[model samples]
Target: MEITILKSVIIDDCTTHRTVLKRLIENHPDLVLEGSYRNGIEAKNNGCEKNADLIFLDVEMPFIDGFDLLESFKKRPQVIMVSGKPDHALRAFEYDVTDYLLKPVSPKRFDMAIKKVQRNTGTMTGQSEDEHIFVRSNFRKVRVDYGDIKWVEALGDYVKLITEKKNILVLTSMKAFEQKLPENRFLRIHKSYIINLDRIENFTSTEVQVCGKQMPLSRKRKSRLLDALGAG
Candidate 1:
């Protein structure tokens, strides 16, 4: 399979945080660092969104806050808001951001956020052909039958693909898996989970039982899940 490298830009006022984020982006195999700006003003003036698919933006910046900078963009890129203050999370969601991370972001959390971006981009691009997908497991390529997957769980930098007789760990994102799987057979019921619809044994408003394992269901996704099952 060919790799899709996403162009990314960093807009933050703090030098230390910016440097750390730059390193993280550079280290990711799927991301390409395009530009780094010290403030939102500079980022906006340079038309960062025009050339980038992803943006790591700071909520609080020196002149023209992150929100204002977003407003200025005619076409917005996928944004991951990095802020010291958690209070901006609610407002950030209003813009339908990919994810919000508090300052001093951990590697695990950052990886999760990037997964969200990858998934969102996949939806925009289009879904893959159903049947099977090739995944790397145990340092070797493995072909997973879509029908055999019971559910998928998100790990920090990888996803656990659970089938009836085995659990395969792949160095990939949940969003990436969600995109590859046939939508008719799978549904994302939570941020960290995507279950094979045929494997569901029972479900409630708050949880789902699949392969004798219960997984939490997000309230926001409950209605969508029901609709997918033709129960809504």
Candidate 2:
């Protein structure tokens, strides 16, 4: 399975810690460093927090402390608290954070924290338009809203995601990519195609049209597709 590419931001008052965390995130394949802020105020004012799917947050900072910063978010994303002290671990849990990373974070521990984030982002499929998944394309994380996707096409070792905004070619097998979608919303109509049920304008016995393109609908899977579309 492909790791979900997280849109990540760092908030730390210490220049040294911020630099270190930034390097680690940049080096990891699953993380895409969106921005690095010296303090909570800088992070807030820049509007980086709103767009981020994950935050590598420092528990102690100027202007607003880490706990206070968590409170400020109208909608908080997955937060991995990074602190120098072990004392705040219990208090941080009350906020329902993804994980807590101690300062001078080791690479091994960092990866473990990431695994939690992956489980949350990967397995859970949301049924609303507000929900989204990040796909790796052109060596960057591209966020695609559930409502925007029209279909997914199998392309050898990769799958081409056809969306309303743009087409993205992700380095993952079709069977693997199919698992990321909500089964009730998406149906595999053929060996080569999985179409968004909401986007279907019309279809025939042999083919279905999506995003103005005719894609082959294998006979074997057509009954399953029909059942999915007919279901509530």
Candidate 3:
């Protein structure tokens, strides 16, 4: 499938960071950097649709941070939080960003995250469907049916997978899981939580009840979840 350019914005306080990010966006076949801002105030004052398709944002900035700017937007966009430190990753996930890109971002890592977004973009329009994910378990590789996943939670460098009757913890980044799982079926409700939509029994703006457990629901992901349910 041909990936289309999505309306995008970049917000960072560092000039070098902006330059690096701009290059990455320009290199991507499916991303268009709409504007670059030094801080949240500039982005907020521009008077454009706060509902951008994607946002490459810095975690710490003068005047207002990325998190504050995200709150100001009436309709939050798909956010990819950019940070220079690993400590803020948990906070980034609390906002349920699309992906977290560490400083000095690698082209490979950036491309991987973009692919996940592209897949979701396609699924939103009924263009494709992915049925399973391959994982390394017990010193061997195995395929896990997408439907079998109940919920996934981050555990440091790995993620705990809860399936129909099994709980498996794999040593992998949550971003890997995000990329492997189909977005239409799996939604990231919080930094630590990703749940299968079919298995969801109840959910509020702040939490999703799945497998009889309540997972956090952040403002960043709530709109997307509602839209997914509506589309389904």
Candidate 4:
């Protein structure tokens, strides 16, 4: 699977803060820094929001604020509001912003925000509720049906899709794969395992049986997994 890199833009009035954000955006493998603007007016005038997938916007800017700029966009992308004020959090969420990060962002918090973006917008370019997905295997693309998949296992940097017939290995992150799958049908029981809810024949507190294979179940996700399976 070829993961689609998110085209991101950074808009901030402060030069120092913008520099810090630019570094963070460039460091992320999945994000491609498209443009960096000093203010929302400059970003709007240059049409930076035209083809951007994500935006790191500062709420307080000279002349035009972040919220005003967001409202001006006819077609808005996913926004992660970076501001010093905690009061803007509630209002930011009202606009359906992906996340609101306080000033001087940590690497860990930035990663969490990126995960939220991945969950909201999948690696796939377009949005779809289709039953099938195409994955690369053996240097070729193979279409896999959602119903046919029994489970998914994380193997090093890749993930193995286990079906009734064969297990196909694809180069992709588990989080990225999880975003592609329907939550109702698939449940992540452990960090490395996502199982098909319908395929589970039996389960205990510590493990689940799918196609005669026992999969380890995490204590934290045990209740959620059971709830998903309707066995709680």
What TM-score does each of the candidates earn? 0.56, 0.52, 0.58, 0.55
Q: Give the per-residue lDDT of model 4 (tens digit) for 60-131.
A: 999999999999999899988888766575466557777778778777768767866775675644435576
How do these models rank on TM-score, best leading?
Answer: 3, 1, 4, 2
Arrange candidates by lDDT, highest first: which order?
Answer: 4, 1, 2, 3
Q: Which candidate is the best by TM-score?
A: 3
After the best TM-score superposition of candidate 4, give how far the Cα of residue 35 lies from its true spot, in angstroms.
0.3
In angstroms, the error of model 2 at 111 is 0.3
Model 2, span 57-128: residue lDDT tens = 899888899999899999788888888876676566557677777778878768756755765577332244
Candidate 4 error regions (>4 Å): 124-232
Question: Top lDDT: which candidate number?
Answer: 4
Q: For candidate 3, which ten residues in a row score worst on lDDT?
A: 120-129
Off by over 4 Å in 2: 1-3, 123-232
- Reference-based lDDT, residue 101, model 3: 75
The lDDT of model 3 is 0.76
Task: Report each candidate's C-alpha RMSD, comma-separated, in the order given.
Answer: 12.3, 16.2, 10.9, 12.7
- Residues 15-93 of candidate 3 have per-residue lDDT tens digits of 9999999999999767887898889999889843364688888889999988888778887777788888755654565
Q: How close is candidate 3 to the true structure, as a TM-score?
A: 0.58
TM-score pick, better of 1 and 3: 3
Model 2, 116: alpha-carbon shift in Å? 0.6
Task: Give lDDT per model, in order.
Answer: 0.81, 0.79, 0.76, 0.82
Candidate 4 TM-score to native: 0.55
